[model samples]
Target: MDRTPANDTWFQGKAARSIHEDQLKKVELFNGRAAMIGFVIGVITEGLTGQGILHQIGLGPLVDGYATCSVQMLPFCF
Candidate 1:
């Protein structure tokens, strides 16, 4: 039985596409992780800095804005 040349090319294209999709998924995962770390760092820094500034300004050091978020939604994970 002779293998069709077009079938070989199709399989090669499919394999390449699969690899591309995997790479895309990896990049997306990395970006998500980076964003999470950055958000945590930013929140901590902002809380500290704002508390200091508010204290200097004679206002209350702790405020109610710490629990706010940009993309507010129901708890996703915890």
Candidate 2:
């Protein structure tokens, strides 16, 4: 532990670490807000179109086919 300026700069105090942690917190908050907004938009679109999220994304047939095969006990659905 020579306590040189370079070593001091590399080892930050609690305040400096807190600043970086605050930035990460803000980023996580914004990401969570965006996810909530997207989910609400998806629900509204589904309500207006009378279609599920999967159907709106054009995966309804693929999902339905898989369900049918699974129910019929098909050997290889993949």
Candidate 3:
């Protein structure tokens, strides 16, 4: 069997499509990971700085109380 220009063109098209699909998958994975990392960092930064949603919604005091209680309870359990 002899390879012709038409066959070569078709093969090239398929290869291009496969390459495009692989690249798209990589981009999607990268975007998802980046978004997750950004969200985690934002939450941590907000929690540490004490200016995030928790503080804005008045949950900060409740959380602080819970933390304090936990610390107080540790000595009794031992």
Candidate 4:
């Protein structure tokens, strides 16, 4: 294992060696916090609107439209 300048530079350039464990931990913590916040927001929205998260986002109609079209052989639904 020679510690020459070129070898050191090459090792540094490697993706596996570039990212530190501490950076990954930070990213994980940030993602966890974001998910928690999003879940709280969704719950609040559901409570206020009396609808689940998907319904609040207007996916309910889209999904129902597809189901109805499929079942009844309709051309389109919205």
lDDT of each: 0.70, 0.86, 0.81, 0.81
By summed lDDT, which 10 consecutive residues of candidate 2 come out lowest?
Answer: 69-78
CA lDDT, candidate 1, residue 75: 53
Q: Please identify which of the two predictions, 3 or 4, would achieve the higher TM-score against the true structure.
A: 3
lDDT of 1 by residue, 13-49 (tens): 9999999999999999999999999777767766877
Write model 3 residue lDDT over 5-78, tens digit each, in one string.
99999999999999999999999999999999987887887878867756655788866666666565865542
TM-score of 3: 0.61
TM-score, one value per model: 0.60, 0.68, 0.61, 0.55
Tell me, what's the RMSD of every candidate?
10.2, 3.6, 7.3, 4.1
Among the numbered candidates, top TM-score falls to 2
lDDT by residue (1-78, candidate 4, tens digit) is: 798999987887785655766688899999999999999999999999888788877798876667667645566554
Candidate with best lDDT: 2
* Candidates ranked by TM-score: 2, 3, 1, 4
Q: Report clashes for each candidate as comma-separated counts.
A: 0, 0, 0, 0
Worst-scoring 10-residue span by lDDT in model 3: 69-78
- After superposition, candidate 2 runs with Cα above 4 Å error: 1-15, 70-75
TM-score of 1: 0.60
In candidate 2, how many Å is residue 62 off? 2.1
Candidate number that wins on lDDT, 1 or 2: 2
